[model samples]
Structure formats: C-alpha cells, structure tokens
Target: MQTSVTFKNIDPSDHLKSYVQDKLNRFDRFLDNPAEASVVLSVEKFRHIAEVNITGDRLKINGREETNDMYSAIDMVMDKLEKQIKKNKEKIRERRGSRGAVKASPMVGFADTLAEEDAEGEIVVTTIDYKPMDAEEAVMQLDLIDDSFLVFTNAKTDEVNVVYRRNDGHYGLIQPIR
Candidate 1:
C-alpha cells in the first residue's frame, strides 16, 4: 500500500507520518492488488480528527474518527479501516468461491463422495449487525439484496427475526417464541 499523510492546522511531525505508514502497511495483506491511501489529520479547537481514504482493485473504503487527541483518533480510524478491509476481502472470496464450485451429479460415481462430504459439512459462521427494523422495512431491504433471506432485530418486539422469500412467491417471517 502507498500512503500519503496530510496535516491541517498543525505542524507536520515525522513521528505521526511514520505511525500512519506503519498502520497502513498492515492492510496490504488483505488487499490482493496494490492500494493507495490518503490520510488527513486536522485539529479544530478541542476536537482532533483523523480521516483515511483507501482505493484498491474495484473498491474504496473510508474511515473517520474524532477524539481529544490526534493519536487516539488515528488508532480508532485504523481499527475501522481494518474491519472494512476484512469485510471487503470476505465478499470477494465468497463471490469467487460460489462461482467456481461444481456439485457432483447423482448419475456419476462421485455422488458417493459428495454425500460423504455433506455428512461432514463445513460450517461457516458469519457475524452481521442485527439492527432493529420493522418487518415492512426489513422486507423492503430484502428486495434490494440478492439474498433470499434476511436476519434482523425487530423494532417492535426487540427480538431477533428472519424474513425470507418463500418458493411460492410470498414472504415468510420467523420470530422466536416468548
């Protein structure tokens, strides 16, 4: 990753520049292609702000943090950037994996191998922010995504819920029993 740091309303410090470079270097592994990062550090009265913008491959990520100190703001913004990088990488990997995978046909002898693999299935755990939303709004959100199902926290009941598109062209909702 190539990084450039800009200081606003404060004297440029070599220490701060080096710190940002070191932090940006860690994200290079998450990116398959080379990336460019632009960082801005500014101070307004008592508020210190750090902002970073990164562009690589076909994606862009931005993170901003405000704190009483510049270093803390930089650290917080870096944490946010790391999360964004990991999420982007995971999405790319998922797209590639889903497209390349081929299922064995039942007519072929390989069906037995596939059955054994299914018996010892690989479990994947994905963490999503279950933001509270009403059922109608969640249904609308599901329409915007390519996925058939969505998991969300219900605003009215304050419980985890799922909304899925049924095979019959209707939608179904799932809620846990009280």
Candidate 2:
C-alpha cells in the first residue's frame, strides 16, 4: 500500500515516519487493492495524536488516538481500525443468506425538524450537477475539493448517498433506504 505521513506542530524525523509506516502496514492484509493510506501525527499540549485514513475499493476506514507517546497513539488508532474492519466484515457475512433476494421497501415519513442555526452571515446557495459514482470515488472527490461533504448517486444501486468528513478526521457514509 502507498503510505504518506505528515507531521504537524512537530519536527519531521525519519525514525518517526518509519515507525508509523511500519505500524500502518499491518492493515495491508485486510485490504484488496490497499490503495493509499495517509497518516497524520500531531502534538497538542501534552497529548500526542495520531490519525490514519486508508481508502481502498469500496472501503474507507479511519482511526485516531491521543496518548502521552506518539507510538502508543499510533498503536491505539490501528487497533480501533482493526475493530471497525472486523465489524464490517461480520455485517457482510450476516447478509450473505439474503443474497439475490429482493428486499421489501422501507416505509418513509417526514417529521417537522428544526432548521440549523446559521452563524455565517446570510444564506448562501450553490448548485451542482448530481453525478452517479461509487462511494470510493465520491470520497476521493471530497478530499480533492474544499467541501466537507459530498452527495452523489450510487452507481450500483442508483440511490442517493452522502460521504462526509467527520470531526475525528474520518469519513462517514450515509445511505438512505427506500
């Protein structure tokens, strides 16, 4: 897998870089294409923070941890990522029994919801064409742009899906059931 390490508010060292790369390489066995992994190491006051993002095929997993030592933070983050991948694998296995079976449509209803508080001056609106693509490509486009979230139609199911960057420096996918 292609790995890139970035250090913020800390001096870049070959030793630290190699350490992170070595730790992230353990996830290679879980991925098919492996794609690329981005690791960010930063220091906040007394805490050492490590964040890892790996995107491959239809999977995008991210994990972050803060500890007194950078190496320990990296280890914790990798452990969290492993747990997420295992959980996702289990979910897929559970659904294998329903393979090729058409599922019933879910009921939909709308309830009155409060509007979001806008603190940034007046309302601003922008429009863009909705394109159909897979979740992986949608995330790649989000990273390439300045937006925090992207909405696109899923190429496989033709359903609307959203890919957004989370506060913990990870990506979140939202798929609406119809």
The candidate maximizing lDDT is: 1
Off by over 4 Å in 2: 100-178
Candidate lDDT scores, in order, read 0.81, 0.76
Can you write out model 2's per-residue Cα lDDT over 108-162, one digit (the tens) per residue?
1111234445567855444445578888877766654436777778999999888
Clash-forming residue pairs, model 1: none
Output the TM-score of candidate 2. Answer: 0.53
Model 1 agreement with the true structure over 99-157: per-residue lDDT tens digits: 64332122311112322333346744445555678888777666544368778889999
> Residue 90, candidate 2: how far off, in angstroms?
2.1
Q: Alpha-carbon error at 148 in model 1, in Å?
A: 30
The numbered model that scores best in TM-score is: 1
